[model samples]
Target: SQQGEEDPQALSIQEGENATMNCSYKTSINNLQWYRQNSGRGLVHLILIRSNEREKHSGRLRVTLDTSKKSSSLLITASRAADTASYFCATAERSDTGRRALTFGSGTRLQVQP
Candidate 1:
């Protein structure tokens, strides 16, 4: 499988603190995406950075890619209680099926203390 692996299977932080997560994949990829899942909600796309790009940011979220190292990191600044959720890094790769879909990692469950 081309799925990536995320470190820190779980994290707990105060409401106003920051949270960071890391991901590592085994093979070459076309793109990497960050997703957030809250409770029973479906995964929501947070950001997508192509393999050629190194970094991208959105609102309070920051993502960095290291293609050479086959790794990526996501950082959330001044996290809120609402930010409590699971973060997953998915990778898209070329496939013979003519289209590629993201392969999700195990995810990092983040808990924000109120």
Candidate 2:
């Protein structure tokens, strides 16, 4: 599997702080995406950075991709209690059938203290 692996399996921080998570993959990819899942709910798409891009930002979230190193990092600035969730990094790669396939990491569990 081309599934990525997230670092710092869990994190705890106070509200208004920043949370950062890293992900590393084994294969080449077309694009990488970050997703947030609140407890038992579905995953919410956060950001997507193409292989040709080095960095991208959305709201208070920043994502950086290093294609040479096959790694990516997600940074959430001014985090809040509502931002507590399991963050995952998904990589999109072209499959043998010429279709894009997504592989997700184990995820980083973040807890923001109120």
Candidate 3:
């Protein structure tokens, strides 16, 4: 099973609408983060909410984490066509490799109509 998994595989909305995505994991983590990708290319970090942090927001995005339930959610406000991309939640486990590696969820693909 994936360390992090997102639900509602895809979503479609219009500009000015709101989009929400959810992720669930199976293990303990030091932190959880959200990322965005366009056209399946490189990802850009969006927000990071530590295990101890319950919620965080940046610009039109809001993220919430529930360590106890091992779940997280992301909300995009006033969606725009520019926000048409895949949103992912990733977490890093303590690795013996001595380098942190991210385990990404399946991801939520958002389509915003202009």
Global lDDT scores for all candidate models: 0.92, 0.93, 0.90
Q: Which should have the higher lDDT, number 2 or number 3?
A: 2
lDDT of 2 at 6: 95
Candidate 3: lDDT of 31? 85
For model 1, the run of ten residues with the poorest summed lDDT: 93-102
Worst 10 residues of 3 by lDDT: 92-101
Q: Which candidate order results from sorting by TM-score in descending order?
A: 2, 1, 3
**What local lDDT does model 1 show for residue 36?**
95
The sequence of per-residue lDDT tens digits that candidate 1 reaches over residues 1-114 is 245899889999999899999999987888899999998999999999999999999999999999999999999999999999999999998566737877889999999999
lDDT of 3: 0.90
- Give the 10-residue window scoring lowest on summed lDDT in candidate 2: 93-102
Tens-digit lDDT string for candidate 3 (1-114): 577899879999999999999999987787888999999599999998987899998999999999889999999999999999999999976456636788999999999999
- Residue pairs with colliding backbones in model 3 are none
Where is model 1 more than 4 Å wrong at Cα? 95-98
lDDT score for residue 34 of model 1:
95
lDDT of each residue in 1-114, candidate 2, tens digit only: 246899889999999999999999988888999999999999999999998999999999999999999999999999999999999999998466647868999999999999
